[model samples]
Target: MKLSKPLIIGIAGGSGSGKTSVTNSIYEVFKEHSVVVIEQDFYYKDQSHLDFEERLLTNYDHPLAFDNKLLISHLRKLLVRQSVEKPIYDYTLHTRSEKSVLIEPKDVIILEGILVLEDEALRNLMDIKLFVDTDADLRIIRRILRDINERGRSIESVVEQYLSVVRPMHNQFIEPTKRYADIIIPEGGHNEVAIDLMVTKIKTILENGTELYYDDDINQ
Candidate 1:
């Protein structure tokens, strides 16, 4: 049987807003099928030409920091039933790896990133858009812990970057894009009610064999 068009979901939020958790929950439910997950961070433009110090100074939270055009092309390919080799970015090294992840065309596509909803072309491609709203205090704390424990960063560096770049970028670019979200999720993946609703909606789209961009603000 021919499968219906893939459902493209965009999950956007500030760093450490639990976007990953929300995405993981959805992925777990649909793991039996062909589901490809992509991260905007993986499409960060190569900074191999720049010194490590220069790369560190790059405004990662800014939309220009990502190779969005490439990402959009990849997503378009997946939508048309074509496989793509997604890039792999190394956070610790501040560079993209030579290797790429081979992702087959999927029945569902989940694009997760802090600035995923900021791009116009990318936004147009999404079947559903979600924004994870979390308090700045909570987000900063989570970012600190994640960077220190997972990304091997020092507490001072993390705090400095948060104050200098992350906070400002989120205020200017990320927060403004919240209006574009079809659903605004508070507390991220911890909100089971919201997650369940979203999952059910996706399942409904699959079962109905059609995509509903909006149904009189049904989910809002």
Candidate 2:
């Protein structure tokens, strides 16, 4: 089927702010059709050459940690109805996987990550930019849990990283980018009202061949 210009949506938030949850909610809504979600995490520069210990020391929360050039190129390709080989990242290994996921052109694309909003070229491509805001304490708690369960991090290491880099980088980069968001969804995906309004906007984009402007009164 002929697709309209792909609606590029970006979800940006600090680690553990439920960016994934909000992205997943949108994906679930469009899972039956031509919609694909790509993660900024997948674009982390390959660190396979570094030893595990050296990779561990890397400040991953910083913008320099990602291969934004590749991400931008892929997004441009997807925008032009071309397919892209999306990189697969290994969180456990702290490197890119040998294999990649081949993504076909879709009507909607969701990009989720901590630093996605920091790049002007990337943010320019997004038709809708969403910022997920959760309390710092809640975010820290979620980060600890995810690092432990999903990434095999020890409690001590999680806390150390949070203090040494994550929190500082979040304050320096992620938190400030909130002002750029077209919509700010407090409490992340738990805010059903916000999610519903986002869905409503997506449906409108699909129905009409145009993008919707961000309105301050969306969820109010």
lDDT of 1 by residue, 1-220 (tens): 3334688999999998989999999999988975778999999999989899899888888889999988988987887678899999999989898899899998789999999999998998899999999999999999999999999899999999999999999999999999999999999979999999998998888887655332222212
* Clashes by residue pair, model 1: none
TM-score, model 1 to reference: 0.93
**lDDT, residue 19, model 2:** 94
lDDT per residue as tens, model 2, 1-220 = 2334788899999999999999999899988977899999999999989999899888999999999999988987888788999999998899999999999999899999999999998998899999999999999999999999999889999999999999999999999999999999999979999999999999988888654333322112
Model 2 Cα RMSD, Å?
5.7
Show pairs that collide, candidate 2: none
Off by over 4 Å in 1: 1-4, 212-220
Best model number under lDDT: 2
